[model samples]
Each structure stands twice: as C-alpha cells, then as structure tokens.
Target: MKLPRSIEEIRSDFPILSVKVHDKPLIYLDNGATTQKPVQVLQVMDELYRTANANVHRGVHYLSDIVSERYEAARETVRAFINAPKREEVIFTAGTTASINAVAFSFGERFVHEGDEIIISGMEHHANIVPWQMLCERKGSKLRIIPFSDQGVLDLEAYRSMFTERTRIVAVTHASNVLGTINPVKEIVTEAHRHDVPVLIDGAQSIQHGIVDVADIGCDFFAFSGHKIYGPNGIGVLYGKEKWLNEIPPYQGGGDMVASVTFEKTTYNELPFKFEAGTTNFTGAIGLGTALDYLTALGREAVAEREQALLAQATGGLSSVSGMRIYGTAPGKVSLVSFLPGNIHPYDAGMILDKMGIAVRTGTHCAQPVMDRYGITGTIRASMAFYNTEEEIDALVKGVRKVTEMFA
Candidate 1:
C-alpha cells in the first residue's frame, strides 16, 4: 500500500499544510468540508485567468477558442474519470447542491406527479434531502426515507419493501458524510432498477476517497463537488446517462442553453450545454481536470489505502480515550470519525482543539436528520485525507484528551 511518491513529497504539493494556527502546526481534519488545493490546480487556474480568460462556446476569437477547447477537454476528463458512457453526459454546475437541484427540478417536472413517491436514505445530507422534499411538495408527491440501523447501516430489506408502483425515483448518497458509511450503491441501483426506477448517487463525499465508475455502479445520475477533491470551489459535475439527459428538459435557460431563439419559439441546446446556461466556470472546470489528473497520477487505490491507514490509526487512538463515544462505527466506512467527548458540548471541545491547531467540524454537518436519529445535537468530526499523516492522528488524539480534561 505504499504511495507512488514519498509522503513528504506528496505533502509538499499543498503549501497550506505547513501553516501554523495558534502557534501549533495545523492538523486539518476538516477535509470533508473542502479539501485544500494543491499548487498544480491553483497554477492551472491562475494561468487560465491570466492568458485565456474567455467565455466558452460563445466566441470565435483566439482566446475564446482556446478556453472553450480546454473547457470541453475538462468534460472529457470528467467522463473518463467517472467512466461515463459519453462526454455529453457530464454537466458542470455550481457544486453538488446545484447538481442535485438541477436533477430534482428537471426530473421532477418531467416524471414526478401527484401521489408519486421519491425514495431517499436516512443518512443523506440536506443537499439530497431538501431538494426532493421541495419537489415532493410542489408535485404533491410523497418523500419516503429508508432508515438506517444504530450502526449506520441502511436497512436494505426495508428499502426494497418500500418500493411500489408509485415510486418515481430513488436518490441516495454513495457515502454518508456524518456517518462515514460507504453504502452499497451498486446494489442499491440494482434493487431500484428491479422496480423500474432510476437512481442518482450523491458522490460529494465518496468521489475523492476511492475509485468511482458510474457505468459500473449503474446509476442514472452522479453528482459531486470539485472542492471536495482538491479542485476549485464553485464548480461541480453532474453526470447523467445520455438517454436520461436527453429525456429531461433543461434545468436553466440563458445564452448557451438555447440553440436558436425566435420570439415565438426557442429550441434548447443539446445534452451538456442545455444544462449549462450562463457563462460556465471554464477556469474551474480546467482546474478540476488538473486535480483529477493529479489524483490519477497519485493512484486512487494507493490513496485509499493511505487514508484507510490514517482512519484506522485515528479510530483506535480516539477509542482509547475515556468517556469518548464514537458514532458511525459501520464496517468499511471512509476515513472519518464523529464522536462526543463525555458531557462536553461539541462546540466547546472544538474550540479547545482549535487553539491546539486541530481543524475539525463540530456541528450537525448539514445532516440534521442523522443527528435527530441519534437523539443528539451534534458531534466532533475528524475527517482525513491521503495527504494526512499518522503523526497528525496522534496529535488529534492528544488534543481531544486535553479538550475533554479542560471541559471536565
């Protein structure tokens, strides 16, 4: 499970790793929020802004052509990265939230109706849950939740039984952000298809952790944020099957989304462009492509192994601390742990950890339903990435213990 390059060499790619917060080295465990970008992604984006800054697909000038080529090339990169069946299936959006909204609006308008049911899981982030709820409200449809167990595992039997002729679509997360559970999305897709329903996978947390093949997973739509994977912010990908993309109407209407416009009739553009209305984030897309290339070079399998080792170290160290109660103990989960240190409020403990230069998220983490399920307000989350080290894990353990004692 050795990395293709030395860990120190890999760490050097991200300059922020060397920073000192509160006079202690920053132990960034907030990777689930957004990953720190490497210099490669930053440099490419800066280069684009400096040299070839132009609106894509709208100009015939030199700069516009170059930027457009690079922008569309980024789409190919996304298609290859996810093993999508076609390049036109990849649509760039603001982020995962926007991607889901596009699907919810377009898909719901086309297919959902009164009394139709939308199925989602208990572990879904608000991004996944809220959009479907809004759609259900608009169409008089019902939102059905597939509950998870105390161990954070979804009840597959319940999910299968819930499906009926009324079910319209099934949307779920490939992994749980709060629970750190890697769901059986392939199986979930298979089961949904059995009932003639399509599935959408929210890959915001799952994309950077391991290999993702939408073709293999057999999902109709896959959405993820670039910033979650060391790419630029305000950029994301929504990969839809070609058939589905063509079937659904455009999510937006603006310049490039229309092929030809008359006062009376306007024909929408084809596949990917139909969804990308205004000026697309060409620089962000190129930067995301660079980030994907960087991950490809690093070897996703090795990166997963490295992160798993870090997760193992973190889980074991955190578990040994007295009065520490860890959540999301599902087997084969990703490299994150959410826990409460005794009776300490998560924010209080998080503040102490921050002074020690450990950055962890202390909140419901945009998954309030999960917190309600556990009957708690929030928990402290330490999410790891491949660039993290075992030393950082140990430092976090010591920091948490200090926070616990201070609170006590």
Candidate 2:
C-alpha cells in the first residue's frame, strides 16, 4: 500500500464518504467530532468478533489465546504510534474522558493536597477541565486557568507565572478543538518542569494532525481518543510515564487488573493491566490498531499537507462571505476552521449546511468556557481530515454564503 497521491484515492477507503445525505452527496467536514472509519478498521474488528471472540488473559482455550495475543499486539501498536518508551505505558480506556478521569483520580489521590492547585487553560475541552474541577472540589484544592489571547493562542508567560508552590499538576490541550490552535506542549512541559511540576497533554484533537511523540514533548501523561482519528468510538488511550504509573494507585480494581486476590488480601496487576479493569474493549483496541496501520501507510506528512490545503481553501473562500468572522487566527494552527457569519446562530448555519449535504459542527463544541471568553454562544466548526477535498471545502464555503445571504 503506497501512500495515496490524491484525496479521491484516500476517500475510496471510507465507504461512508460515498453516501448521500438529503439527496445530495455528503461532504464530511466534521472530522474533529468523530471521523468516519475506513473499511480496514471495520474488517479487522469484525474478524476478531467473528473468529476469536473470548475472554482474554483468563482461559487457555485457543480463542482466548488468539484474542489476548491480538489485544496486546494492539497495545504495542498504540505504544509505537505515540512513541511511548514502553508498551506498558499505554492503557486503554473507554475514551479520552475516561483516560483523563483515571489520571485525575489516581494522580490526585497521590499528589494533590488540600491547598494545592491544578493548572489548565481557557481553551481546554470540558473533559480536561471538569475532572480537575472535581478533583479540586474533592480535595479542597484550587483550579487555576491559564488565559489565552483573543486569537486563541495560549499565553506561555501567563502559564509560567501561574505556577506557584501550591501548583501540583498542569493539564493543557495540545490543540484546541474549537479554535484549531496547536499549543506548544513541549515548551509547556519544559516550563512546568522548571517549577518541578508534571504536565499532562490532552491530545484528543492533536494526535490525528501529526506525530505526537510524548517523550519528545516530555509530558508526564497524554490522552487521546480513537474515534477522533478514524478508529472505533469506545476505545481511547492514556500514555503515562512508567514512574508516574508506578506511583499512582489503581483507578479501578477488578478481574485482569488484579495480580492475586484472596478474601482478605489482594495484589494488583502490573503497569497497564493495573488500570484496565473488568471486561476490556479488546475488539475496539484491534480496530484502533488497524486504524493506525491505515493512517501510517497513508503517510502522516502527506495527510497533513492535504489537510492544510483543504483548510486554506475553506478559509480563503469563506473569507469572501459578507460579515464572516473566523475564530482562532493564530499564526500556528491545524487544518480546522470555526467561525461565525454575522449574528446568525451557528446552529442555524450548520442546519442549513446539513440540508445541502455539507456536514459541519455547530454549537459550543463542548467548550462552553471558550464561548464565554468570546462573549458568544458558539461558532460553526468545519474540521478537515486527510480524506477531505478542496471540493468539499468549496461546498462548505458556498453553503455558508447561502446561509449568510438568507439571514442578511
């Protein structure tokens, strides 16, 4: 499988891209919410459930062995994808929400004291914010937010200044889901380390954009979702440094997460298994592996270039629309666009685009604090993926123009 030379070839792998919506060809520009899975991912997951479905790490049966082996193989795939030092550092969870929650609970229990503070940013998705808020509320700690510029870039100076003796941990997003801004997480990690604080990056929106080397970024922990990257919905990854994973107590205890158990005394499993409790999403993990395989075969650099082209087209075309207000005009950003055209509600524009079979996301985008910062309810978001084309961006631009004229 040589890398795709054009968007059409890349689009062929995803069957849903061929479908019609409202009797019009579907233009999927909402990849940031959840990407449409390729047939490769589907086939891999289906094969597992069909032939090798069984409880993993428990039975000596052939099916169980096959399932368990494949499941761990998937873990290796995840470890390599993020460039984690050890495969055991990659822990599977329901999604990014669950991953962040696990870190907040276990890390908070270990380190966060009553007067301590957890640092996050104004641009964070609620998944990153609320968990720390919950942890703070529980431990009588404080939640401090690093402010961003109106252009949607995080203020590093503010980030540096916010750290104090009470600052226990720092959690920030690698990229803004709503703003399309790519944060300097390496510098963030370095700055946090200067104050002897460990940093965790929310890579939910960043992973699919380009290479995310956690070691290179020097982050203590990283979390991202599979669904956002053309994989299954129920699977996500949490990559923690072995030292941190070793120190934080298990977030949950059951079945595979235990090493030995008696009625009175119980011993927990090692590294990854200590976090993976009860029935694991073995099938979903397999699908995620396939998704990563497909993505890598396509070439990350090529995909990034194509996405940037799509973003350029979308941004340039939409700029011509009267009263257009594009958000997040940072010098450095990924290939996604979120904007408002006049005072027209984002939902209204999004619905109109949907009617044209031009799919786009609207509303707070699960980042209400961002909306509050801008003193607006929400903006329409059109996030691009490698499979997206200039034609789709054209359709979105045209749809936006039509929507704006209707309201004008």
Candidate 3:
C-alpha cells in the first residue's frame, strides 16, 4: 500500500523520533501509550501560549475573545472529526480517563439504580472497567462482563444474551490496548440498541489508528484521548448525544458549568459547557485540533494502511523466534503485538530493549484482566504507528532474539 507521503517526510514531522537513547538511534514502538506530537501541533500550541493566552468564555478582553473563539472552534473540529450530529454534543475533558469517569458519575446518577447491570467486555482498559465498577458499587448495581475467546475476540453471542431490562448502559472498547483487537463495535451498538440500551465506546486506542465515526457506529457516547492521536496531553473529547446530554446532570459544579447561583439553588449552563467545569484546557484543545488537522491531511486511510503493513511485518518477524508466545492473535488486530520471549520476565526484556534504543511497553498495559485471562503476569508489547518503518520492525525482531538468548 502506498502512503500519502514518503515515510521520511512523515517521520520528519515528529522531531522526537530523531532523538537518541543510550547512544543508539531511538526506535519507538510505544504508540499504544501515547504518540509523539508533530511539530505542527507543537507550533500551534506554542503560538497560542505566546500570543493568545487567556481564559476562555465570558470575557470582554481581546485575548479572551480570540482564545475563546479558538477553543470553541476546537470543539467543532472534534464534532466534525467524530461526525457527531450536533456541535453541542462535544465536551472536552482532561483525557479519556476523565471522560469515562464523568459519564459514570453523570449517567449513573441519571439512570442506574439498585440491581441494575452494566455490560463491559473483559478486554477493557482499567479506564473503561474501573469507572463502571465504581458506579456499580455506588449505585448498588452489578457490573457484568462480556467474555472474550482465547483468540482475544469478544463473544458477541454472550454479549447479546447478557443484556436485560435492568441494564443501564453498554461500555466497551473500540480496540483492545493489549490485544490490538479492532472490535466490531458497530454490531455491538446495534445489538445493544435492540435491547433499548445505549452504548459508550472507549476510543482511546482506536481513534489514532483509523477513522472513528460516531454516527456510523451508532454509539450514544464516545471518548478518546488527544495524546494518543499525536496531540497534546491532558485533553480529550467526549461526544454524547444531545438527548442524553440534556438528560444527565452536570459532572461538576464549577465556574463555567453554571448558569446562575443563588442561595437557595444553582442552575447549570447549557450543553457542552455543562460538562466542562472550572477553567478549560483551551490551549490543549487548540493543539488537539491542529493534531487532528495534521492527521487528516496525512489521509487516515493511507495512514491505516501503512500501520497495518507494519503490524503484519512485526507479527511475522516476532512469530519466527523460538519459544516466543504472542498473547493476542485476533485475525484483524491493529498495529500492536504483546508477547513473552520464552519464560523471560517482561520487565527484564523491556530493560534490555531500552538499552538497545528500542522503546516498547511492558507489563499488563493497564489491562490486567487480559493478562489474567492468559495465565501470565505481563507481556512486552511493541505497538506501531504510521510513522514506524520496516527497518524498525526488523530491529525489534533482532532485539527480542537477543533478549531470548541472554535469558537462555
């Protein structure tokens, strides 16, 4: 598959990719945690801080007005990127963790009651799992899990049978961070809607890999982190349907989320702002918008193709090693691989790889349940991005071989 631009050209956009570690050229394969930001995103953020730094909304000053416009424009960009029906449906939060927690609190308060059930898959990151678990504990509800196969595919048949009248909402990941499984969320949403259940997709891992159309998936809510998509840290988008946004209470009681405050009572602001309490991340939001624009210009389809090619290469190269055990072998996974080289502990393997200037994620990867399911403690994971190259994949293979020999 052809990339939208040359690999060198695309890699040049991210300055950090050129940096060395331990006197060796850096080969970063940790995109699953957070992607390196492009210069375009960095420049926009720097420019905003330099020229238009100010608080957003309800300000008469020139800096505030300009910054506010940019901030709201970032919301619109997020709305468009996710293909949400209304711009007001988009809410900015600290990141995916914050987004999921906000929904758990607000949506739980609005809908959940004693004995109610919430359906989440076994492969979910803690961000998706714990909030629901907290909500269940708070509301005297039960948290139901959808089991996955040994191959890392969710049991849709079991998922369909799990919903009941007491079911409040269905929360699932669009892609598994550890498994790299690209779940059939559209079908999952359809099944939930058949039961009159609303669905929330954790898009933190999927958004950076491919197109994420909320309308197409038919999920009622979606959450993703900006940093995972080559944007600034501490910014994320939560897209909720208008009906739900209107129904749920504000997540926090603070400055911008209020319409008025009286001694007797306090009224809340309108949609979007209702969820955005206190001071907003206006500069980070603008930076995220620039990052989205940069990704769009690169052509998401072509980017996906490049990443898939890298995934294939990594999978093949890693599989050839003796005593290698890959954890997630789903057929249509994203660009990541989780594995153990023989009985070698993941932490030891990771340290050796780091010394060789190859960066990879180690341990349970925030998905301890996934590790438990496989009867292992943790795995060394190499996650790829569009900027990653074939040479890097080859290097990773060689590094793993070295790790295996050292342990032997």
lDDT values, one for every candidate: 0.95, 0.91, 0.94
What TM-score does structure 1 among the candidates reach?
A: 0.99
Residue pairs in clash, model 1 = none
Ranking by TM-score: 1, 3, 2
lDDT, model 3, position 390? 95
TM-score of each: 0.99, 0.98, 0.99
lDDT of candidate 2 over 226-330, digit per residue (tens): 999899999999999999999999988889999899999999999889999999999999899889888888887777777777788888998899899999988
Q: Every model's Cα RMSD, please?
A: 0.7, 1.3, 0.8
Clashes of each: 0, 0, 0
Which scores better on lDDT, 1 or 2? 1
Cα lDDT tens digits for candidate 3, 1-408? 466779999899999999999999999999999999999999999999899999999699999999999998998888888899999999999999999999999999999999999999999999999999899899999999999999999999999899889998999999999999999999999999999999999999999987889999999999999999999999999999999999999878889999999989999999889999999998999999999989889988888988998999999999999999987888889899999989999999999999999999999899999999999999999999999989999999999999999999
Name the regions of candidate 2 deviating beyond 4 angstroms.
1-3
Candidate 1 displacement at residue 290 in angstroms? 0.4
Q: Model 1, which residues run further than 4 Å from truth?
A: none
Between candidates 2 and 3, the lDDT winner:
3
